[model samples]
Target: MQGTILLTGATGFVGGAILKRLHLEKKRSVVAVVRDSSKVILENVPKVCIEQFDGSTQWEQRLDGLDVVIHAAARVHVMNDVEDDPLAAFRNVNVEGTLNLARQAAAAGVRRFIFISSIKVNGEGTAPGSAYVADDVPAPMDPYGVSKMEAELGLRQLSLITTMEVVIVRPVLVYGPGVKANFLNMMRWLDKGFPLPFGAIHNKRSLVALDNLVDLILTCIDHPAAANQAFLVSDGEDLSTTQLLSRMGKALNAPRRLIPVPSWLLEGGAALLGKKALSQRLCGSLQVDITKTRNLLGWAPPLSVDEALAITAKYFREHH
Candidate 1:
C-alpha cells in the first residue's frame, strides 16, 4: 500500500475523475468521502475505500491516517440570492468548511492538502487583454469567487503554523462528458445542430480537461514544487471561443454550424441587459500560462483539446 489518500467530493465531477484514475495507476488506498455516493463512484475503482463525510461533521477523525487530502467539495452555484444572505451560505461551506478540514489534516500528519479552487477566485469576469498569471492579485466579483479567495488565503495562513503542504489548483471552465451548467447547455444546442454566430468572435481562453486535471492533482500530492504553491493549469493549448465550440461540435459528431454575428452586436446586447460582465466570461480571454507549473514540476497537461473532447463525446454517446 502507498498509504491512504482522503478525497472530499469524491463523487463530484472533478473529484470522481481523479478517484477513477488513482485506483488505475497507483497501488495506494483512496478513501472517498461522499454525501450520497452512487454506484458509479464505486465502480472500476476497486481499491477506493468509502467514507460518509459531509462538511458538517467534525474532521479530526476523518483525516486520521491519511497521507493526502484533495478537497473538492463546495457550494458550486452560479448565483444565490436567498432571503437572509447569499454570500454567507457560500462562505459557510467554501471558506469555513475548507479551513476546518485543513486544520484537522494538519493535526493528523497529512502530507499534502490539495485544494480544488476555481479561477473565479482570480476574477468572475474578464477584461480585455487581462490574461492573469499565478502572481496576479485576485479580484473575485461574485460570492462564489469571493469565498474561494478567502479559502486560499486561509490555507496559506494555516501553512504558516503547520507541516501540511498546501497546493491550490485554480482551473478555468472544466468540461467533459457529464459536464453541467452553461457548458452542458451549449451541448444541447450543438446536438440540435442549431446555427451559432460565434465563429467570428476570436477570444482565447484556458481550459482543463478531466484527465489533465486529474493527472496534475495526483502529481501535486507529492511533487516537491507543488509544496506550498499555487498553479493555474490548462491543456497547454490556447484556443479562441470559436475554436472551442467548433472542436466541441466536431467531437459530438455535429458539423460546425456557425454564422457570422458581429461581436459588437453581442457585446451591445449583453451591456443592455447588465450582462456585460457575464458576456466577458463567455467570450473574453482568461488565458493562463502554465509555464511555471511545467517548469517547476516537470508536468504537462495529458490530453489535447481534441482528444479530451472526443473522450467526453464518446462517454455521452455511450450513456445517451
Candidate 2:
C-alpha cells in the first residue's frame, strides 16, 4: 500500500471510484492508465494513456516501479451483443489483452496483480439456499464469463512461474452512487411510480455496494493472505427482487407500486414473449457466499444495503 500503484480503466465506474478513493486517502504515487486522459478528472494523479490493451501495447514503461497493478479494464458484458463472434470479441480483450498486460506487470517486478472478475464464472443462477463459493468448479455460461474464467486460469498459471502474486476478486451485482444499467433502470421505474409485477418475487440475489467492493480491493492491495487467492465478495445480505424494489422505493421516497404477481405466471408470460432471460434475472436466485472474503481478510461491508441504496438514490435525484 505504500509503494506506487498502477490502475487500469480509470474512466470506468469501478475504476473511477477506486481512483477517487485513493486520491481522498492521500495516496502519493497513484497512477491511472486510461485510453483518454481527458476522461479522467482526478487531481495530482498522473495519467498514462494507452490506446488499447493488446499484444503490442507497451505497458513496460508505465508499469515500471509499480508495486501493485489493479487490472479493472475489460470489454464488459452486454445483453444484446451485435458482434459477429461474441466469444472471440470477448477473448480479444478480456483474455488475451488481460494476460498480455499481466505478463508485462509480472516481468516488471510488480509485487502483486489484482484482477477484478465477475460472479458469472460460477454460472447464471443458483438454487434458493445454495450460494456460489470462490473455489467452486467454474461453470461459466457466456462469452464474458468464459473470458474471465480464461483470464483467471492464465493469471494463475503466470503466478506459478513468476514472482508477482496474483489475486482475483469476483463480485456479484455491484450498485451504489453513479450506478447505471439495470440498477439505474430499476431506480428510474421506482422514482416514476411505475407499477411492476415483482411484488411476489421470492428469489434472492446477493449484491455488493460499490464502497464495499473498493474496500475489499484496497485490502487486497496489501493483505498478506490475499496472495494467489480468489475471493467472492458481496454485502453479506441477500434480498428478493420484491424486497429490493421496496427498499429502493423508500430510498427514493417513491410509492411501492408492485403488483403481487405469481412467479410462475411471470415466467410463463416471459417465455411466450421471448423475455425468458429477462424474467429469469428478475425472479431467479443468484446468491454468492462471502464467508471466504470475511474470514480471510477480516473484512465486512462498511455500508448496509439500505444505507447504500439511499446514497445511490440521492445521487440519482441530483444528477438525473
TM-score per prediction, in order, is 0.91, 0.98
For model 2, the stretches where C-alpha displacement exceeds 4 angstroms are: none
Clashing pairs in 1: none
Q: Mind sharing the TM-score for model 2?
A: 0.98
- Among residues 3 or more apart in sequence or in different chains, the pairs in candidate 2 whose N, CA or C atoms overlap within 3 Å are none
lDDT value for model 1: 0.81
Best by TM-score: 2
Residue-by-residue lDDT tens digits, candidate 2, 259-294: 999999999999999998888889999999888889
Instruction: Kindly give the stretch of ten consecutive residues in candidate 2 with the minimal lDDT sum.
Output: 36-45
